[model samples]
Target: MAEVLLVVGVVVAMFVAYNIGGSTTGPAFGPAVGAKAISKPVAAGLMGLFFFVGAWTIGRNVVTKLGTELVVDPGVFTLESSIAVLFFIGIALLVGNIFGVPASTSMTAVGAIAGLGLAGNVLDLAVMGEIVIWWVVSPIVGFWVSLIIGRYFYARFNRMVAMERSTGPLLDVDRSGPIPIPRVHETTNRRELVGTITVVAIGCLMAFSSGTSNIANAVAPLVGSGELAMDPAIILGGIAVTIGAFTIARRTLDTMGSDITELPLTAAIVVASVSSALVVFLSMLGIPASFVIIATMSIVGLGWGRATRPVTVPEAVRKEKAPPVTIDALAADEPGEELPPIGEEDPDKIPQASDLFNPATTARVVLMQNVVPAIATLGAYLTFRFVPIFGI
Candidate 1:
């Protein structure tokens, strides 16, 4: 029976990792694919590679916390309770994807596990409190750093990173070699190549950061329960993530590549860099960072900071604080999903993407994401408290 339960736990862990792979590709590589700097297949491959690298190295920090440190006693993570915790996380992932709401995977995983710990009398207040503190601090750091960049250096950065792909082949084929090799040549404009490379590089950074924080969400419970060792669990989870990258990531590469509030290239780069860096930092500290919240806040900060750059503090207090006629503001009055750009079509169309990042909407979106985690917490608590499988 224990052996059967171990197999079931591992299967659930893979399911969680698969969902994570599909969900994360959009955020990690969307900008590169959106800019046409790389194809979807290439993006998927890079995401998998960097994710594995991150998991093998820095991701262990976060796994340690989820698997051992979050609870007062690791013995509390029995196979039955671990499976129950994973079920809640898997449910959160499924609901979030089906409904087009991007919940924080790490947060959901933490919530479910913490719920298990709480019900089993093993919850660690210090560790949980520390995780909560970092969750708040990291997003705030992301916001302020992005805000400073937007207000001060954004224009210059935008001008510098202005990269358009050339009409010709980006790489020159060398037939002289025994095997033909495609390499950059004199035909490649240095500036355009640099810009293209930067976008793709940032995408890689995002993938790596995601691996750092997210790998633990998939395999930590199994490892905690002693059903699987850390090394094998990480390896299995990596394989599942790779499968997701190659298979289910295509649709997201299209829809979220440009949608999810229509980000410009520079804005995407800045937001990705800031948020990814923050996640990696927190992962190193064994915290399950909330990438979605941090990235959303970064995006909102960039837009708000840039928009309010020309105004003074008093002007901002008097004018900028007023509710702008944004899509969120008019979402009720408007009818359907076919709203046009703010200026290009009818006056009642949705506000420009620039105007959609008001503080209220930003807060609401972040708070909305928490719903999945909250549900997972509640479900986990109830199941462990009453379920016979927990052996309580």
Candidate 2:
């Protein structure tokens, strides 16, 4: 029975680790991917490799806490209880995936453990409270930090662009045709060296931080249970997460990168840095956190901060001024505009891509990503508590 339970625990841990990679790699690399700095496959591969490295190295501390420290009495975590916790977490992750929500494996695992503690009548209120507090605070802090950093970076980037424009074409190019290429004489060795160093530095930091912060999620459970040695668990968890990064992380990355905000490369870097800091801090506190929530909220907050003006539409449409009344205009108009000819269209149009990053849309997408996961967490908690016949 002990051996069977250990196998179950390991399997569950692997699933949790995979889901962690799927949900988190986006936040780690989405911005880079969005900015075209890295291809999706390469981003996923690098993210996976770094996640494994981090898990194998500094992730042991978090694993230890998850396996043993959160609950009051270590003796209460029998093999059966561990399996039950793993089962609940796995189910929650499955549900989140089905709904296209980027749920945190860390949050689900924490909730499952807490639920198990309650079921076993060994709930540790103090530790539970601490975890809850961190859950609430970390995302908020991450959001604000990202907002400030994103704003600063954007400001600097715009200023740089303006300076370049004023300095007379940084790239000397003949723009006579559809395709334009820079003149060879325009290229400078000094500028090329600086650009190369900057790109390399950003890539290294992004990969390193991603790996370090995410390791906690993959190995925490195994380390906490004392069933597997910490080092081995980290290795296994790292491999699992890396595999997941390569396979399932791309979808979530696209959702975060393109759907959340139209982020410039610098803004994306700011978001990544803020998110990594928040996750690492929480891991140090032994508090399980949702990287999905952190990254999404940060991006959303950045969009909101930058959206200085509210969207408004004209209150009334003058019939004559509405341009040749017709069924098409009547159908397209939201309440006020009467009609216009189908063929008569406004040649000067507001681009749809510009509206993609509008504050309302950003808020909606962020909320959708977060709310579904929260609901899954609640469902997992309730199912674990009341579904007595299943013995979870």
Candidate 3:
């Protein structure tokens, strides 16, 4: 019976790790894939590699916290309790995937453990409060930081473009023939070099941070139950997460990259960087956080805030204007010239109203994207809260 239960617990842990990969990898690789900077397969492969490295190197801290630190007593988390936690988190992630939301596996794990701890009389209200507070603050901090960075970069780009325009080199215009091109000096600028270095550094940091903070989400329960040692847990968790990233992370990636907001590479880097910093900080402090919510909100808020204005249709496409109909002057007088039948009304004509009011669709898509993730988080919480009575 003990062996059977252990096997079951391991299976549940694997499911939890798979869900983590689906939720977290989407954010980690979504922007790069959406920007066309990398293909989905390449992103998945890279994420898998980095995730393993991260889990092995720095994931120990988070794993220890999740398995041992949050509650008043570690003995309260029995095999049954661990399985219950995994079930709740897994259900929540499954719901998020179905609804196309990028829910946070970290949040789900925290909520489940908290619920279980309360049931087992091991609740530590002080630690729980701190964790909840970070949950609230992390996303807000991520958003404003991303917003500031995005705006500053945009301003700098505009200034550079304006300066180049003012330099006003002689232009060759041809009225009747092609103009000859002139060769100019090719040199990299200090700004470009600095920006490139900063972006690469941030990417590395984000990858490392993600791997470290999320390791606990998968391996903590197993460790708590003495089913696995720290080193083996980290190795298993890392490999499992990498596999999850490569297989199930694509849909959520599309939702984040294309549906929430159209993020430029720079804006993506800023959001990812800010989110990673917050996650790392929380992990170090032994606080639990939701990375998906933080990263998604940051990217969406930054993208929306940076848009020049709400999208509007061109005047030529508005519905108020009547379509111009031409009647040939000669055809009007000649009865013998048969009037061409109004070309069969095309069924595939684009709706003018839709074109003008396109922002509504964008808004709906964004709302759904955000709401689905939140619902998933809540679902995980509720599942664990009611698990004792439900006997899951």
- Give the top-scoring candidate (TM-score): 1
Model 3 pairs whose backbones collide: none
What total of clashing residue pairs does each candidate reach? 0, 5, 0
Ordered list by TM-score, greatest first: 1, 2, 3
lDDT of model 1 at position 346? 39
lDDT of 2 at 111: 68
Q: Quick one: RMSD of model 3?
A: 14.7
- The top-ranked prediction according to lDDT is 1
TM-scores of all predicted structures: 0.88, 0.68, 0.66
Model 3 lDDT per residue over 1-392, tens place: 76887778877887777767766766776655554445677777777777777777667777777788777888766777677777766776666666655456677677677766665567678877877788788888887775554433433432222111112222233445476554322443444334444544554576667777777877787797777788877777767776787787887678756842333445556667778888888777766566666776676555433331122224224633233211111011121222222222221231222121135554554465445435544553566457574333
Model 2, 262-370: lDDT tens per residue?
4454445556667777766666665666766787677655553333111111211222232221112111222223323222334122122343134565466456545
The runs of at least 3 residues in candidate 2 whose Cα sits more than 4 Å from the true structure, single-residue gaps closed, are: 31-36, 39-41, 150-153, 158-214, 250-261, 307-392
Worst 10 residues of 1 by lDDT: 327-336
TM-score of 3: 0.66
